[model samples]
Target: MIEENRFPVIETDRLNLRQVTKDDAESILAYLSDQDVMKHYGLEPFDSIDDALDEIAWYQAIFEKKTGIRWGITLKEQGRIIGSCGFLNIVSEHRRSEIGFELSKEYWGNGMASEALESVITYGFEQLNLQRVQALIEPPNISSQRLVERKGFIREGLLRNYEFTCGKFDDLLMYSLLKQDYEKMSYST
Candidate 1:
């Protein structure tokens, strides 16, 4: 079984992956409500600040229950939350999980997502003993698809009409990396 309580924080070279909390409402609102960030993700603009606050509370509750791990990605130099990243839909028995992430528009093209995902993928394999890690990217999200590919995740296939978002069904592309592949890359580097 995965021990969710054993690890709380993961540090990357330029970012700190810390647990999401209700107090993060303000910071999360800064990006979560941005229309640019939510556009291709099939989410509507946050109608009110209260919506962001409630979302943070919901994430905190999920963290407390050991259902998933969410992190506020804070830049080390400024100590400001520029993004969020984490594992979702963890299935311990199957030794697999889905990964999700988002960054403030300002941080785009800076390789922050790639850096953070590398660190988190390492943690999932080495610390959590997961056998596989996967990312589901909407087809039009070319940036995210490139990020996953750059991380050495192979394109598995497409899940047709896999999710309903932005008023209609959307297709998803699945990409995955195995524990063995990660280990090989680690040793090679």
Candidate 2:
């Protein structure tokens, strides 16, 4: 079990990362239900508002368990939920995990995702003391690939037929960054 103190609220210049709540259902539905956002994510668009509500409930349960950390990303200025970001598929024994994120289309191309990811990566390394973090990008997600690369995650290689999305198997590009590498880069900067 993760210690409660281990997970603290994190904020970046333009974003606030906090625990998700049932009240976030509408905001979650705003982005999650968009077909554009769901295209490369390997999941169907939310069928109804109830689906988003159920997801928020699941997120709340996970939060209480202290196993996986998820956050609802809100714009600092507007105080609106633009998307979600967090550590998914956590494996404590390995001191490693996969990071995932999604933002509303309106917020894309504005560097919000990159900024949020940088903050999360720093948190994973500095606060969580994790050894490594990984991200799997779908083949066609060039924007996401660039975002991870800018954050110092190296593209390891491709995992062919790695995920089933939109009724077909999709290739995924694996990327990872190590705590040691992050430390070195930060020290240099």
Candidate 3:
């Protein structure tokens, strides 16, 4: 089972990740509504503030149910939300989970995603005792693929017509990182 206290305030030199709240609706909507941001994410671009609110509610419920978690990624320097990242399809019995993330388009290529993802990945391996972490990305999202690969996740395979989003069936490039490998990398770093 996932630890009840899995929801943690994770911090890095330039970022802070915390629980998503209803109060974050506006900031979250900023990116959730952008086509460039939600293109690969399962849901359609959030059409209104209510869409963000509904998703936030869903995010909270999933954590409460011990099924998943979504961290609101905040940029400390600006003191505003710039993105979100977390695990879904978490199966503690199998010691594995799927990871997902998206940042505001304006903040792309700034290394913030790396900072946020590292904190979450470490938390999975160390605190949550997760044995494997996986990322399923749309085949066309080169940046996301590179981000996970840079962190040492290996491309596992491809899932064709894996998800139907944005009015069509989308393919996903599966990436995985094992806890043992992550530990080895951590020690080396």
Best by lDDT: 3
lDDT of 3 at 73: 93
In terms of lDDT, the poorest run of 10 residues in model 1 is 1-10
Relative to the true structure, candidate 3 reaches a TM of 0.94
lDDT of 1 by residue, 70-181 (tens): 7789988876777888777778879898888899999999888888888888878887788989999998899999888877899999999999987899999999999888
Top-TM-score structure, candidate number: 3
Q: Write the per-residue lDDT of candidate 2 for residues 91-144, one digit (tens) a residue.
A: 778888788899999989898888788788887777667888999999789888
Rank by lDDT (best first): 3, 2, 1
Looking at model 3, residue 31 earns an lDDT score of 90
* 1-189: candidate 3 lDDT, tens digit per residue: 466755788888889899888888999999989998987788889989999999899888879888788899998776577798888888989999999898999989989898889988988888778999999998889999999998889999999998887678888999999987897775323
Model 2: CA > 4 A from native: 5-7, 186-189
lDDT agreement with native, every candidate: 0.81, 0.81, 0.87
Error of 2 at 129 (Å): 1.1
In Å, residue 47's CA in model 3 sits off its true spot by 1.7
Clashes of 3: 0
The residue pairs in collision within model 2 are: none
Alpha-carbon lDDT of model 1: 0.81
- Give candidate 1's TM-score: 0.92
